[model samples]
Target: MPKLGYTAAQIRAAEAPLLAKGVPLMIRAAQALADHVTSVLPEPSASRVLVLAGAGDNGGDACWAASFLAEAGVQVNVVPVMGRLSPEPEAGARESGARILTEAKPVDAAQLVADADVIIDGMLGIGAGGTAAGGSPALRGTARDWALAVHAALTENPHPLVIAVDLPSGIDPDSGEVAEPEAVIPADLTVTFIGIKAGCLQGEGAKLAGKVWLEPIGASQHLLGVPPAVTVS
Candidate 1:
């Protein structure tokens, strides 16, 4: 396997063709995540899932996956901890006919986050750049606070299994550098999209990544014409 860390730009560029082909990255990501969650769940039949969805595509994925789990008769809660969601992906998850807790339920997310069997950390992704990206002091602070809550819950409560979408909430995807280490919500399993990155393979990023999984999300086409850093014979 190739070892590398993908920048937010690269990941977004890769999504171009797939998005064009009508490939639903969020849906596919969610489905893959849901499948994995199902396999390892101590009791998939009757489990409570708490999805900490941010405002980005990562959050969208968690929302969709929670919807699937909810439909299966599992108790699922979609916590939009911050920001909003993408249109199509959010709509798809809504159609799955699950209960979504908007910003209105911040208290609920905080409570369920402490007592849930599983927590899907979809707070951030590679696209973590621009105004909302590496994170300004304010954004990082928000993420740091979120992390503190999770850490407290994990230590004091049931210590739920965490499955992160893409990178953890406060981590930098391109550089794999962490600003708010305290806010770093380490993943028990990370369902990543496209190819692997440098950060997830080494450094503090590795520990945070935990068990890494790659989903194509139909993004290879975008890399077809681009020159790769390495070419094996």
Candidate 2:
């Protein structure tokens, strides 16, 4: 079914109450994501998955998902786009046997992207400042390099299924605009949480997010009270 879309702010506001009450939102998101990933895998034991995780809640979701994938005997490799990962995700990934690469070079990223059966794009999410109209925004430092390398690998190989966490990095969750379309990870499937984002239905987001899947993360629609902005069949 086509899912209801909401603005990032609306989603945040709806989640605030649950977060304040210490709901396991991240874990729930990860579990749902892992379940979908497992369902798609041809052979779990032989599959290799790469997660490009940033130091944010979205990245945390990917990490937790990686942990679950690891427990299922999937070889998971995580590349931290930021310098350090958040404590909870880092711990979860390590405990579940997912290898967290401390120092990821361009070659490392290319190799991982090329070898993986699935690539989880968790580098950035709804909070990112999307690209301007005239040109693409510049990504600083290692994040830039990682984006470039991954983009290149995907373009060249075009094999592994790319699954974006929440929203694809470099996408405007509210507007569906992209700062750098070339650098953005084109998700074959985007497993969004809380509510489908408005951005996923229009502009560059529609093209970048090949197919969209919504996971509510146990948040009630009554609590969200988010009216659907648009719907895609």
Candidate 3:
């Protein structure tokens, strides 16, 4: 049976209690992401993965996943497009030997995308405007530039598998809108946590989110009685 999809608010509400209780949601989600990434690779240890991390927990999730990938022998390169990352996950990535590309240029981002076997998009999470933390609906600054680089690189070399952590960076998680279409690169697979998001089921979000995979991380019980905002076939 197809699962129901929730809005950002609904998912966040459900996650709150777990987070308050100090559940290791990010780590579990990262493990799931790392497992799925390796599952798709022919030889994971020999693969090169590029991670686009922004200034949010979604970025933290990616950084944690990078640590796992690095430990698994994958060459992981992380670009902090938003100039910051959640401290813990960032440290985990560094400790696991993932290269942190602090200097992010569009040209360099393009080259990284071109060379990657897989690209993990964790530039944003579900939110009303852009991020759950509240920002412009459209990607701005280095994030936009890097996204454009990714779009161009994919256009020229479409070999890399693009994986979105939760939601595609620039798309609205509730409405499925793309305010700046060019700033969002389509994902080959999206490993969303807790629940499927309504955005992934419709509009430009559906197009960008190629395949949706849910990694609930024990949030299912909390969401069990709560009605979903959207359902899919």
* Clash count list over all predictions: 6, 1, 0
Error of 1 at 43 (Å): 2.8
Query: What's the ranking of the predictions by lDDT, best on top?
Result: 3, 2, 1
lDDT of 1 at 10: 64
Cα lDDT, model 3, residue 207: 92
Q: Model 3 segments beyond 4 Å from truth?
A: 127-136
Q: On residues 63-171, what C-alpha lDDT tens digit does candidate 3 reach at each position?
A: 9999999999999999998888889999999999999999768788667977899999999887444344364557888888889888888888899999999888888
| CA lDDT scores, all candidates in order | 0.68, 0.81, 0.87
Cα lDDT tens digits, model 1, 109-206, are: 35777667888888777654522343332234344456667756666664788888876666656455676665777888888877554456655667
Candidates 1 and 3 compared: the better one by lDDT is 3
Model 3: C-alpha RMSD to truth?
A: 2.0
TM-score of each: 0.82, 0.91, 0.94
How far residue 78's Cα lies from its native spot in candidate 1, in Å, is: 1.4
Best by lDDT: 3
- Model 2 RMSD in Å is 2.8
Give the winner by TM-score: 3
- Tell me the lDDT of model 3 at 228: 83
TM-score of 3: 0.94
